[model samples]
Target: MVSSDESLPQRLPPIDRALDRYPYCIVWTPIPVLTWIFPFIGHMGICMSNGVIRDFAGPYLVTEDNMAFGRPTRYLRLNPKNVDGGSSAWDEGVSKASVLYGTRMHNIFCDNCHSHVATALCNMHYENRTSWNMIILCFWMFVCGKYVNVCGFVKSWLPFLIFISIVVLMAVYF
Candidate 1:
């Protein structure tokens, strides 16, 4: 038989172990200001201003580091067969790479586009460049874990983008 650890799925978190364990609470990501989902400014706090974790049950939010919150991703439930307790170093790395690649790809070509500027968001979901490498290791709720605003509150930041751009363009032209 394969060792439990070896059998583990490389990229997916052990939701079974999570559910088998403790009571989860909500906390904000350290760079909360960078993420619209997080209401509190920094560090995991008593309340998650708009944390995605604040909305769930089984996928309880567990505070890991001074700056991280943990929860399994919806990918586990949505695609259970893929959940194997195997080596995830490869998979996790790829996902991170995919995110970075997607962000870079999106930004390089679209940053100047109105929709992109209108959103007025940082390049990607992540911030705090220094802590980036450790972000995957940090036990934290997946952005799509318990909550998925899909731009619920963040969308509000859009209208102003158009307003600001128009003013800037006027200044440049006239």
Candidate 2:
């Protein structure tokens, strides 16, 4: 006879433990063409326990693939507090949201991969739902270097910088 603790896997990191207990995981990987110009423009997905990733691949297609945008560079835990408790309730919620978005049309600026992940997390009632917005903003700051010292500067000027860069790049190449 073995103790309950002995039966469970040992020495896992907090995030790893969370992944094992949670129904879904958020993952990030670089978008091929976009990463060439802006390394920060990456794709986000909700990875189920079976290693199937649900992501917005393109318009009218929410895909479940092993390698959505190559291998994932990062895995973000959905809810850290729920790591020990282990709830299955959110699983159906996330799955329903995924199917809903999967059938809808995709939009680059508005309804893209990050939005898909965000919506899933939101359905799960995850607290830190602003992560998607932060990811985009941080990447824009990284690429444009709009605000080196001030957060306010980035908040104020990053949009204009992004707009200018897009217009300039479009004019030059297309």
Candidate 3:
């Protein structure tokens, strides 16, 4: 007899780093001075089912594929299966959020990149929840995100490390 699990869809497409494609994922990149001082803070974007990225880069600008800050150093791959309509629903959610955000002003405190990602997740109703927010998204990404590679890992943390080191040396010396 065939197993019930056999009817379920297979895994999502693989991430292609060279192409900056991360299907069904939330991608993150560190901001220059902000992330160096506070490692948990960074820019975020959501990927379409086909791995294309959509992010609120600035006021009324929702860019595709080209992230505002730079490439993603960490990512949290989400399962399309979690959505009611799977991949198509995931793409629609990202699209809808991008369009909506494109008309809104970008506020570093409230409406920002993290807010954009949260809106997409809420639109998709991932995990049957619609309470996604910047704080929640930020916390989850910081705790669960995986570095794209060794270089990605260094890019995310090295600057923060150097900043801390300098602070410690200054305290000891002067």
Using lDDT, give the best candidate's number: 3
Model 2 CA deviation exceeding 4 Å by range: 1-23, 80-86, 128-174
Off by over 4 Å in 3: 1-9
Best-matching candidate per TM-score: 3
Comparing candidate 1 with candidate 3, which one achieves the higher TM-score?
Answer: 3
Candidate 1's residue-wise lDDT over 72-151, tens digit each? Answer: 21211222232232123222322333233334322212221112211211122222122322233223334433321335
Note the residue pairs that clash in candidate 3: none
Q: What is the lDDT of residue 69 in candidate 1?
A: 27
Give the distance in Å from residue 29's predicted Cα in candidate 1 to where it truly belongs.
Answer: 10
Instruction: Give the TM-score of each candidate.
Output: 0.22, 0.56, 0.95
Q: What is the lDDT of residue 126 in candidate 2?
A: 55
Ranking by TM-score: 3, 2, 1
lDDT of 2 by residue, 48-88 (tens): 64445677788767777643665555555444344332345
